[model samples]
Target: MFKYAWICKNPDLKGMARRAILQAMDTKPYSTWLEIDLGAIKNNIKQLKAMTGTRLMAVIKANAYGHGVLTVAKAAEQAGASWLGVARMEEALNLRAAGIKSEVMVLGYTSPVM
Candidate 1:
């Protein structure tokens, strides 16, 4: 079983929480972190769902393409996504580790022998 090592941080204080830590500006020190706007994502998903009138599958991988996976998955789940797609077993396991109960598929494939 793979373990989830990523930590979700409050971006406001730390600045955009990314792979590399960004120092807060000294001149105009404020919340430099880019906060995840989950509500907006949810709204967008809702709009898409209404527009398409079909099921929506959220493809989240590569740590949500550097957008943070766990938080994005949680937001996608809340946004009425019926399915979630990842890139590898570890990524799928990470979503499960994060308490996401939605359907998740790993699109990344490896060699049979690996």
Candidate 2:
């Protein structure tokens, strides 16, 4: 299981650390980092688009299969994905909270109340 030492609720603070000893200008500054090749994603999308006339829907579930949800979703958008798909409301919420304007649909069962 994964555990985090801190979490911030204030959206105004981009890089705020809720309980870290030092504050930074980027959120998750001290968190584990991964490199996602958005260009590669864009290229893949272009290839897929070439083969299919059907509208493209980017499944961004499970953090884009560990490719990072926000980054992949943004790249997919730039690559002409017609819609973004998430497996849960939290995933959709995260995308929206990050300012993603793509059409998003939750693919999994969800509770009615927030």
Candidate 3:
């Protein structure tokens, strides 16, 4: 996997990039908002459990990789997720903002300046 270590080192830049990407898109801001289907995520987790019968963790970094982190984290929890992983503090904060009560692990480091 191509790790975004550079992004990890600079959160302000990451935020700017996110805003820029959103602004650059030739679509309405409302259209950029994504509605994640928690039920679908739960169903998929159930299916995976039935097939594998192993522990499952939800990777919810990068706004759930653009699927909305908190939404997906909630679904993953409802579907019996044993762990939740994120790539940055902001992503974890997003989950927290959504009132998701789950163990969120930040996969990378955050400078003290953060």
Q: What ranking of all candidate models by lDDT puts the best one first? A: 2, 1, 3
Error of 3 at 66 (Å): 1.8
Best by lDDT: 2
By TM-score: ranked, best first: 1, 2, 3
Each prediction's whole-model lDDT (CA): 0.80, 0.83, 0.78
Each model's backbone clash number: 2, 2, 0
Query: Lowest-scoring 10 consecutive residues by lDDT in candidate 1?
Result: 17-26
Best by TM-score: 1
Write the residue-wise lDDT of candidate 1 on 12-114 in tens digits. Answer: 6344443333233224656667767888889998999999999899888898887888888989999899999998888888788879999998888955774
Lowest-lDDT window of 10 residues in candidate 3? 1-10
Point out where model 3 deviates above 4 Å. Answer: 1-36, 111-114
The TM-score values for the models, in the order shown, are 0.65, 0.64, 0.58
TM-score of predicted structure 2: 0.64
Native-to-model Cα distance after best TM-score fit, residue 42 in candidate 3, in Å:
1.1
Off by over 4 Å in 2: 1-35
